[model samples]
Target: MTYIIGRGYGRALLTPDGIFFKGPFRRRSIPWAEITEIEKRHHTARSSEWWDLRLVRANGRDLAVPGAFTSNRYDHKFEAKLALLREYWQRAAR
Candidate 1:
């Protein structure tokens, strides 16, 4: 069984073969074999804040996990989830 973490109303799941993400508007799966890179992006301007987690595939497509961020200065839970994803992704690849 895959381990899943709840991200607000969405969720991120790590399975034996891939990663699964479900958000309000989109759902995505990235097989370990197809993943070329994973990245975290953040942008803050004036009163707005944005954070995204992106997975780059070997076929040149990118899948993003939206709503994985907060405007608050300390988001330990968010950071932990991102770290967990990275760690499990590496493990699945191996």
Candidate 2:
């Protein structure tokens, strides 16, 4: 389970097991099996808003996800990060 916290550069992934983040900016890491799902959504700063959302998953979890990370805002700065998670997931899945 993971969710996006903050906005844009301040985005962070809140994983149930471990919160993944990179300073004031969102970092991309290898997608992981534990991830369950990664959703790219920008809910209105207003409460009670749900739309303009995109997500990815490994299991059956659907938590909030940041865009800066998945979107490669840093030009794949998160490649390693995502790779790490993906590597772990691959091993686990195997």
Candidate 3:
């Protein structure tokens, strides 16, 4: 199972070993073993930009992830946030 928390800068998808990134261009991931803690963050987006969702994973080690590629060509970030929640099922214990 996975756990998710959104922040001002990005959202973190917490899995067994780590979490994924989404926002301002999906970025690399931070390993869980290295994560010290998880924080809830929020942000108000500019009216023109997509809704800003973020999560902070406090880890010293970061991992390279698959490129940020969306296949549908929908070009919607809000929908992408839902995709993460679906793909990385939140951990029951988290």
Candidate 4:
């Protein structure tokens, strides 16, 4: 399954092996066993509040699941997406 992020430009792909992320400039793959944490992150800039995901790896790398466009303000089903991601992580992570 795949989750669209930030106006459909970014995405997170979930598979039996792990999760994959592709953004404008970077790409990352995290195996289920290597994931150490999955958490929601809140960012505020001036008058806007943004919600995104923070995934930590065993090697201490952090990955963000984009929830909104860089030029956009409102979140798009952030809580729902986060919950779903967590569900997958819980089932797969060791």
Candidate closest to the true structure, highest lDDT: 1
What is the per-residue lDDT of model 2 for residues 31-80, given as tens digits with 9 covering 90 to 100?
44445543434454444543322335555645443434443234454555
Assess the local accuracy of residue 90 in candidate 4 as a C-alpha lDDT between 0 and 100.
Answer: 87
lDDT of 2 at 22: 55
lDDT (0 to 1) per candidate: 0.72, 0.44, 0.41, 0.70
Relative to the unseen true structure, what is the C-alpha lDDT of residue 55 in candidate 3, on a scale of 0 to 100?
A: 35
User: How well is each residue in 2-79 modelled by candidate 4, as lDDT tens digits?
Assistant: 344342577788877888877765687888788889876667879776566788889998776654233334445665
Pairs clashing within candidate 1: none
Q: Give the 10-residue window scoring lowest on summed lDDT in candidate 4.
A: 66-75
Could you tell me which 10 consecutive residues in candidate 1 have the lowest summed lDDT?
1-10
Is candidate 1 or 3 superior in TM-score? 1
- For model 2 the local lDDT of residue 86 reads 44
Off by over 4 Å in 1: 1-8, 24-26
Per-residue accuracy of model 3 over 1-94 as CA lDDT, tens digit each:
1221223444455576556666555466655444443322232345432222233334443222222223343546645654663344344225
Comparing 1 and 2 on TM-score, the stronger one: 1
TM-score winner between 3 and 4, please give it.
4
Model 1: per-residue Cα lDDT over 63-90, one tens digit each: 6654466665568877876787788788
Better of 2 and 4 by TM-score: 4
For model 3 the local lDDT of residue 93 reads: 28
Clashes per candidate (backbone, < 3 Å): 0, 13, 10, 0
